[model samples]
Target: MRLSAYFMPTLKENPAEAQIVSHRLMLRSGMIRQQAAGIYAWLPLGYRVLRKIEQIVREEQDAAGAQEILMPTVQPAELWQRSGRYDDYGKEMLRFKDRHEREMLFGPTAEEMVTDICREIRSYRDLPKILYNIQWKFRDEVRPRFGVMRGREFLMKDAYSFDLDKDGARRSYEAMFRAYMRTYARLGMTAIPVKADTGPIGGDMSHEFHILAETGESAIFFDQELEEKSRAGELTVDSMNQYYAAAEEKHDADKCPVPAERLRTMRGIEVGHIFYFGTKYSEPMGAVVQGPNGETIAAEMGSYGIGVSRLVGAIIEASHDERGIIWPEAVAPFKLGLINLKSGDAACDSACEDIYRTLSEQGVEVLYDDRNERAGVKFADMDLIGLPWQLVIGPKGLAAGVVELKNRKSGEKQEVSLEAALARLTA
Candidate 1:
């Protein structure tokens, strides 16, 4: 994408209402624009990042043997009523009446709707199946603040599993558990798995994935060794859950087995959650399958959710510096930022154009800054957007037969011949 033609409306000053680092940086970087309290319109740049995150979530879900299927955003209230949560879900659910005065609601969660779908499976052969979707969800927060972190409208990835019995359900849960760990690892974040209470969903097992950050909302107490292992990519669901990890709110000091010296405490942001809510929705909604002997039984079930839109803010909360967001390579909107330092100069322009073309042709996503902007302005904008690698081409560098390459994360620069730069970037 060419920055000159792109619709990135970066702000020189932070928006007045943004309280958190992610919210402020997102606004200043031209990623999202707030339309109302806790509601936002994802501009093009923001949308690109959102899609990238969603795709990663999708891939991991699929790898765990979950199939993709988009459920409706607006579902019949009757399903919730059958699950006995229509009224118990509280005002956070956007309840309403349709044209003919029938009850309807914008789904805050899809347990009820997914259970109704499982009603189609009539035999034990369909015992194990997982369905998932990445879609927009809404919940009317009483105090929706912190930009997309607590937004009224947001995108989410929710997946549900149906199994023959408790044992089968446990296996399904484990698959998702490992997948979640792999997902966070690929996103360039160390997400610790913390034990959690299954609130309205009513489950015997649950875990919330939290990314540690200084400005995070929840306080966490965990095994210091596990924290290090998670950062070093040495953790699997089985090994991670063996260690003690919990939010401070749910933690008991006396019950903790880890020695005080081995415990590490920090603030964290919740980005994903998984629950095994056996028979909660299925039993109530009559999602039954027939046994070989012809007995009907409610399928054991579980639900997993990842905050797709919230991760946009959560990522910034976890990864950023004074200048702006420092996107992890996996979720970065573009891989490289190619700057034509002197746009109109023939040598510089040709070199940048050739490099940009070569990178693009090599399946790399590059954002070329070919605008007639000052050096400082171009550098600032490039740093603000936070692409992983930046290739700077200027008249001086081209005259010397080299281009300047900078690693955004380390702030390290090197001048190399055009071929060398291209080879390094592609390699």
Candidate 2:
């Protein structure tokens, strides 16, 4: 993508309304714009990152043996009524009436709706089925703030697993647990799964995956060893559950098992959650399957959720520096930023064009800045957007038969021959 043709309307100053680093950087980088309180319209650059994150979530879900399916944003209120939660869900649910005066709602979550779907399975052979969807969800937050991190309208990946018994339900939960860990790791995040309350979903077992950040909303306490294991890529579902990890509200210091020396406390932004509610919704909604003995039994179920849109902000909160967002390679909108320092200079233009063509031909996503702008402006814009690698070309450098390669995260630069630069970038 060429910046000359791209719709990145970057701002020079921070917006007063943005209280967090992620929100401010997102606005300055021209990734998103607020349409209303707690709602935003993702601009082109932001949309590309959003899609990349969504695709990674999709791929991990599929690899975990969960089949993908599209579910409606608007759900019939009867499903909630049948599950005995219609009146209890409270104001967060956007409930209303349709043209025929029938009750409906923009689903805040899909537990009841998924349970209704599972009601079709009559035999145990259909047990252990997991289905997921990546879609928009709406919640009427009384005070929606912190940009997309707590937006009223956001994208989410929700998966529901139905099994014949409690044991089967636990196995399904474990599968999702592993999948969630892998998903976060791929996004360049170290997510710690801590024991959590089941909230309105009403589950016997629950875990919330949180990414550690200084500006995070929730305070968490956990075993210090977890961090070492996470860094070593050795975290397992069993280890996560067995270790001492809890949210602030749930952590009882007196009863904590970890010694003070091994305890680590930090603030974390919640990005994913999983629940094993067993028959909570299935029993109430009549989602039953026949057992081997021919007896009717309610399907045990679990629901897993990852905040697809909120992750964009969470990642920024965890990864950005003073300049701007430092996007992870897997979720970066583009892998390389090609800055033509002297646009229209015959030699400079030719060099940049050749480099851009070579990289693009090799299946690299490069954003070439071919605009007639000052070098400082080009550098500032590129840093604000935060591509992993940047290639700087100028008349002086071109004349010397070399181009400057920069690593955004480390702020390191090296001058290498054009051929060498291409080899390093492509490698």
Candidate 3:
């Protein structure tokens, strides 16, 4: 993609409404625009990153044996009523009536709807099934803030698992637990799963996956061993559960098991949550199947959720520096930024064009800065957008038969021959 014709509307000054680093950088980099107090319009650059994150979540869900499905954003209020939660779920759930006066709601979660679907399984042959959808959700927040992290409307990946018994449900929950760890690892993040209260979801077992950040809202108390294990890529559901981990509200300091030396406290932003609710929804909604003994039994169930759109902001909060966002390579909108320092210079333009074409041909996503702009302006914009790698072409570098390759995260640059640069980037 060439910046000359791109629709990125970057800002030079921080917006007064942006209270967080991610929000400020997102606006300055032209990734998103605020449409309301808690709603945002993802611009082209932001949308690309959003789609990339969604794809990763989809792939991980499939690998965990979950089938993909698209559920409607609007759900009938009757479903929640059948689950005995229509009145329990607070004002956060947007309730309304259709033109015909039928009670409806923009779904805040899909537990009831998914349970309704499972009601058709009359036999144990379909004992174990997992269905997931990546969709938009809404919750009428009283005071929405922190950009997409707490947006009223956002994208989420929610998966529901149905099993014949509590034991089977646990297995399904463990599978999703492992899948979540792998998903975060691939996205270049260390997510710690902490014991959490089920809240209105009404689950017997629950865990929230949080990414540690200084600006995070949740105060987390955890065993230091978990961090070491996470960094070593040795995290497992069983191993993680054995460690002492809890959010601020749930942490009881007097009852904590970890010794003073091993206990560590930090702030974290929640990015994913999983719950094994057993028959919470299934029993109430009569989602039953025949057991091996020919007796009717309610399906045991679990729900797993990942904040797909909120992750964009969470990642920025965890990874960005003073300049701008340092997007993880796996979720970066473009893998490389090709900057033509002298856009109109024959040699500079030719070098950039050649590198851009060759790298793109090799299936690399390259953002070519071919606008007729100053060198400093191009460099600043490239840093603000945060491509993983940058190829800088200038008359001086081209005259020397070389171009500069930069690592965005490390702020390191090396002058290498064009051939060498191409080989390194493609490799």
Candidate 4:
């Protein structure tokens, strides 16, 4: 993509309303715009990043044996009523009436709806399965701030699992637990899975995956070794639970297992959650299957959720520097920023064009700056957008048959021949 034709409306100054680094950087980089309090219209650049994260989540979910099926954003309120949660759920539920005067509500979660679907299946053969969706969800937050991090309407990857018994449900939960660890790692982050209360979702078994960041909202106490082990894919639900990791509400220092010296306190932003709510919705909603003995039994269920849109902001919070966001290559909107130092110069433009075409042909996503703008403006914008690599092409560099390549994260630069740069990047 060429910056000359792009629609990134970057701002030179931070928006006063942005209170967090992710929020401020998102606005300054022109990734999103506020459409309402606690709501946003994801701009092109931001939308691409969101899609990238969503795709990664989708891939990981599929890898864990979960099938993807999109659910409706506007679910019938009657489903909640049948599940006995209609009146209990508070103002956060966006309840309303349609033109026909029928009761309706935007779904905050899909437990009831998914249960209704599972009710259609009959035998134990269909017992253990997982279904998920990536869709927009709305919650009427009383105070929606921090841009997409706490937005009222955001994209989410929510999955529901069904099993014949509690043991199968446990296995399903563990599968998702491991998948979440893998998903976070692929997105260039290491997340700590901590035991948690089910809250209004009403489950005795639950875990929250929190990404540690200085600006995170939840205060956490955890053993340092679990984080390192998480990266090596050596964590299971049982093994992880044996370690000491909990959010402030659940952390009991007196009962802590690790010695005070080994216990580390840090702030973390929650990015994913998994729950094993045995028969919570199935029993109420009649989501049952026939047992081998021909007896009707409620299927055990679990729900897993990943904050697809919030991850964009959370990643920025964890990875950005003073200049701007330093995007992880796996999730960056574009892999490389091709800056033509002298946009109108024949040699500079030709070199950038050649490199851009080569990278494009190699299945690389490159954003080429072909605009007639000052070099400083281009540089600032590129840094603000936070492409992983920047390819600098100038008349001087072109004359020497080399392009200056810079790694955004390391701030390291090297002048290499055009072919060498291409080889390194493609490799």
Candidate 5:
């Protein structure tokens, strides 16, 4: 995308309301704008990143054998009532009434709705079905803070599994748990599975995927070894769950074998969660399947969720540098940044255009900075947006048949032939 035509509304100063670095950078970088207390308008740049994250989540879910199906944001209150959670869900649930004097609500989660769908398609033949969606959800937070980290209205990717029995539910839950690990790992995040409170979901097993960050909510005590290795890549449902990882509430000091010296304690942000709620929703809503002997049984079910939009903010919190976000290649909006350092210089402009064209032809996502701006301003904006690789062209470099190659993470610089730079970037 050309920066000249792009609608990135970057700000020079930080907003007072933004409390954390990610929040501030998101505002200053023109990624998001607050429309209300915790609701945001994802601007062009931010929307691109959000879509990229959502796509990665979708790919992983599909790979794990889950079917994609979008659910409604607004649901009938009758579904929540059948699940016995209308009043139990408390103020966080955004309850409302339609103009016809009928009860309605913006769904905070989709357990009830999904269960109802399963009941409508009842049969043992369709014993195990996995359905998922990427949609918006609303929770009326009493004190909305920290930008998208704890927003009132946010985008989320939630998947639900309906199975014939407890054993089938366990398998479905494990599949999602494994997929979650891969999803975060692709984003260059080390997410530890911590036991979490199931609350109104009412489940025997629940786990929260927490990304360790200095500015996290719950304190974490975990195995020191997990920090060294990449858990996200080398994980699956078959792996033993005997690891010592838990949130503060579930942490048992005596049972944990990590010596005090090797133990690592830090705060973390919960990015994903999975829970196995045996017959909670199915039984309540009559989501039943028949056995071979003709006996009807409530479907065992599980729900898995990844905060899709929140990940854009969480990723910044985990991997940002002094300038701005250092996006992982898998989730970066663009792979290469082409800067016409001397936009007015005919030679430099021609070289940048050629390189940009070559990269584009090679199927590379390049953000060409063609605006008439100072070299410093161009470089700063390039780093601030954190494209993986930046190719800088100037009159001096173009005259010598070379352009500068910059690695955003290490701040490494090299002057190479235009052909070599193209090879390196497109490689």
Candidate 6:
């Protein structure tokens, strides 16, 4: 991709409406545009990050034995009625009517719809199954704020699992819990899973995965060991949930005596949540399977959800620097930004072209700066976009058969032979 032809409309100053750091940075970097009070049109750069996060979530869910499926964003009110939640869901549920004046609603969540689907396939052989979808959900937020972090309409990756009995349901929940830990670890984050209330879902067991950030809405308290695991890899389910962690609502002062120094108190964003609800929806919707004794029983059920679009804002809140977003390599829009320090200068242009071709041949995603902008502007844009590597090809460095490689995270720069830089990057 070439910057000259790209549609990155960066701003010179922060938007006054953006109150939080993540919200401000997202606007300044031209990642998204506001369409309405709590809605946004994701720009190209923002869409890329959203898709990356969704793909990671899908991969982890698949690895945990969940099957993927697509459900409608708009559902009949009868589905909710069957679950006995049509009126209890509160104002957040956006209800409407179709052309025929039939009561319908934009789905805030898919519990009822999924339950209806499972009831159709009920049988002993189909006793257990996991179904998932990555789609947009609509919620009439009373007051949406903080950019995509709290939007009226956003993308969500939700999954539902069915099992023959209570024990099987617990096992399924554990598998998803493990998968969430792995997903967060791969994104260079620590999602502290804390016990939580089931709320309207009516479940005996529920957990919320919160990513600690200074600008988050929910205050969080966790043990000191969690900080060490923040950077450590190989996080198993036991290791991830070994220490005490909870949101402010769940904090118990008497039982958990985390020393002042050992306790990490910070605002945290809720990125993912898992709940094991035994027969909550199945019983109401008649999602029963026949047993060996020829008797029917409601299937135990669980649901897991990841706020796919909100993660983009949450990640920026947790990981970005003063300059702009510092995307994890696994989710960065482009791996490298090739900056031609003297764009249009024959020598610098030639060197940049050669390097861009080499990287492209290696199947690397590189953004080539072919625009005739000043060197300082180009440098700033590269930092704002937050590519992992910045290959600087100035005429002065090219004359010496060397180019400068700068690390986005460490801010370290080194002058090396062109061949050596390529080897280091490709390796």
Model 5 stretches astray by more than 4 angstroms? 228-232, 236-240, 252-255
Q: At residue 230, what lDDT does model 5 achieve? A: 37
Among all windows of ten consecutive residues in candidate 3, which has the lowest summed lDDT?
228-237
lDDT by residue for model 3 over 40-76, one digit each (tens)?
9999999999999999999999999999989999999
lDDT of 6 at 395: 86
lDDT of 3 at 84: 87
lDDT of 5 by residue, 1-427 (tens): 7899998888777799999888998998888999999999999888989999998999999998999998899999999999899989999988888999899999999999989987875678887888998999999999999999999999999999988888888889988988988888888888877777887788989888888887788889887766654353665444435456777887789888778887889889999888998988888799888777899989889999999988998888887888887888877879988888778788877777787888888899999999998888888888888888998888888778888999888889999998898888877
For each candidate in turn, give its C-alpha RMSD to the true structure in angstroms. Answer: 1.3, 1.2, 1.3, 1.1, 1.5, 1.7
User: Model 2 clash tally?
Assistant: 0
lDDT of 6 at 65: 90
What is the clash count for each candidate, in the order shown?
A: 0, 0, 0, 0, 0, 0
Per-model TM-score on C-alpha atoms: 0.97, 0.98, 0.97, 0.98, 0.96, 0.96
Question: Can you give the lDDT of residue 412 in candidate 2?
Answer: 97
Best by lDDT: 2
lDDT of each: 0.90, 0.92, 0.91, 0.91, 0.86, 0.87
Prediction 6 global C-alpha lDDT: 0.87
lDDT by residue for model 2 (32-68), tens: 9999988999999999999999999999999999999
Q: List residue ranges in candidate 1 displaced over 4 A.
A: 232-237
Candidate 5 positional error at 381, Å: 1.1
Error in Å for residue 394 of model 1: 1.0
Error of 1 at 407 (Å): 1.0
Off by over 4 Å in 3: 252-255
